[model samples]
Target: MTQLTQNNGQIKNNYCVIDLETTGLDNLTDAIIEIAVIKFDLDGISETYQSFVNPGREIPPFISDLTGIFDKDVLVAPEFNSIIPKLKEFIGDSILIGHNVGFDVGFLREFGFNFEGTIFDTLDLSYVIHPTQLDYSLTGLSLF
Candidate 1:
């Protein structure tokens, strides 16, 4: 990994990191099971929001195993649409940053998020910073 000083890094002071745990990969077919957003800057995290969404369908065993979020966990939770207002309010106009932002944004778009903010993908940044690494997944990078 390349060393990056605070003054030399490409960190965004006006950004909100977004992530979504969905029922599956297909944005057209699957539903968002969970949502998390963090509003932060150089100082630290200013705000954070997370919620489990009722997908109105079964949570596949594979996804449950991977995310550790099962159907029972979200049974009494609010639906995706119900939390859009709060989610948008928290995100505001900040740039979006995520590991695979496109995938998260694609899923958001399906739920009518229609976000127009700029996006930064940490996965792509990982490839540029550590091109020789065998894995680029979030967990893989952490362990490496």
Candidate 2:
């Protein structure tokens, strides 16, 4: 994994902010059950994409309760592969930005998605720029 520190490494267009809620936190053992993408084109136009997927595995009751995404809700929904094209379109040439975002990128890599360009990790930047803060979670940052 290469850290994109050079000025040349920054993305020049198509910025995207992505978030996912999964059945489990473990990247290897879990799958994305829901995803939300906020896309911003170079011209400052923005769009949004979201989907709920039926992970073949059963979701823990606790997670289902928290997300309100029961098995029945996604039983007939499209799988990740079905939505890859739209995702690719939404992510075109954009730097992916998210809070604690590596797992999402890792999962995309595991699924054979070729993600090039830069990644601006809000969590990492927040930690570095705001070292006095005690929490870096999305909710935590929002409260700051």
Candidate 3:
């Protein structure tokens, strides 16, 4: 990893930006159907990992419509447990950056992965930076 000094003089390189598509909105019950992680360093993207996760249950129709990740799409994919090790290694000592990151962190904790690092939430930051914006969602910010 290419180390770079932050404004505070902390040496760091990896910033793992993650996103997950789940079976539902309830973190306690829903399972992750898809996960994507992109590791960025000073030079740019150092690694990328993505996979369909077999949630072990049928994906609700509405979710399928939203994500295009149907039950059939993940039926042959690896389970969450199978990807934990690789996911951990990919995120090693990296700060996490995401939109609505608490939702993702909740699901990850439910899956037994303990994340102990700095988190940068774009959603919260957007609200502060663009207080008058009608929407602070990822799509909304992207459109702006």
Off by over 4 Å in 3: 1-9
Assess the local accuracy of residue 114 in candidate 3 as a C-alpha lDDT between 0 and 100: 77
Kindly state the number of residue pairs that clash in model 3. 0
User: Which of 1 and 2 is the better model by TM-score?
Assistant: 1
lDDT tens string, model 1, 1-144?
Answer: 222223335544667888899999999999999999998866778899999999999999999999999999999999988998998899886778899899999999998888876777999999999999998999899988
lDDT of 3 by residue, 17-85 (tens): 999999998988899999999999878998999999999999999999999998889999999888999
lDDT of predicted model 3: 0.89
Q: Rank the candidates by lDDT, best first.
A: 3, 1, 2
lDDT for position 140 in model 2? 82
Clashing pairs in 1: none
- Global lDDT for candidate 1? 0.87
The sequence of per-residue lDDT tens digits that candidate 2 reaches over residues 1-144 is: 232343675536567888888887777778888888897765554788989987887889999988889888888888887888889877887778888788888777665566786777888899898899998887787898
Ranked by TM-score, top first: 3, 1, 2
TM-scores for every candidate against the unseen true structure: 0.88, 0.85, 0.91
Q: After superposition, how far is residue 72 of candidate 2 from its true place, in Å?
A: 1.7
Best by lDDT: 3
